[model samples]
Target: MAHDHAHNAPPSETAMRVKALETLLTEKGLLDPAAIDALVETYETKIGPRNGAKVVARAWTDPDYKARLLEDGSAAIAELGFSGVQGEDMIVVENTDEVHNMVVCTLCSCYPWPTLGLPPIWFKSAPYRARSVIDPRGVLAEFGVELSDDVEIRVWDSNAELRYLVLPQRPAGTDELSEDELAALVTRDSMIGTALAEAPAG
Candidate 1:
């Protein structure tokens, strides 16, 4: 709660502990907050879900690319020159009318960073990791996705070696849109199976 936050209250015990640790690390020249900020900014703005969006849009416009992505996600993603430590190996799953796919890292916050940038806070939270596997439809419902009971849900757990990406179904009425236009319709939540891509207004 705002009233209980460290910003509003006296320095919280947890905050004091973290500040003390930061001071110690800074004295030892072991931590640089500016460097951390720069790295985080790189992921949050310059390199983000837009990279994955481009991949999804290309797949939607080109059948061959879609096949390649589904067949070999790592290779197909590397085709776009977006390869890194957390994304050396990736498994792409498709979402259809009858089946939905989701990804989670039960042990830790392993994620496809090259495509997704940084995992959102919720993705790394215990509640999400646990509830996603046990009550996937219920989790999706919390994200405003109410799937039909007839649709089956599949969950994939990602680790350091192989991460998972969900290829959300391309919305209808997008036949006239250009590849870039389609990319604009793809969002971070859609790639994570929490939501669907936006449909063309026309």
Candidate 2:
């Protein structure tokens, strides 16, 4: 958290190219800024991490649902109405006291677009793809997650056929929280296994 990887970094080539294309399209009157903003808003709120957060929250609050989710991820997730394209073959991995789960796509950035909208730039980078498996703890440290040596870290490799979603451990003192309240603590990075769910406010 303290180290903001993208804070001072220059825009990636893909990002720059997208920006240039957007500019050109706007100049040619083919792209409306307002419509672009609206589309981005829909993805960010309606179709992105919010859907994954809701799934996590439901599992936290319902043991039966959690069991079904772990047993058949695709079916369980589809029950929540989040199944499409890249997300058709989902495998939900849960994090417990003894184990932690992280996901990476070594070959390419094959991600669950239905639930997570789009993969982060870091997830698609060559360094992350290669290093996450070789040095998972080190990669996690860079993300500000320091786990005890006793805890086992499992890195799930996603591909074109199967995508993974990390079910982060529920925070303490959240037994009284409602499903929506719990969902609020489930950040995108948490579901991606780069960060933990935020602890509830005092």
CA RMSD, predictions in order: 3.6, 6.5
Cand. 1 TM to true fold: 0.83
Clashing pairs in 2: none
Candidate that scores best on lDDT: 2
lDDT by residue for model 2 (46-92), tens? 78888999999999999999999999999999999999978988999
Cα TM-score per model:
0.83, 0.79
Per residue, candidate 1 scores C-alpha lDDT tens digits across 140-194 of 9999989899999998877558888899999998888999999999999899888
Each candidate: how many clashes?
Answer: 0, 0
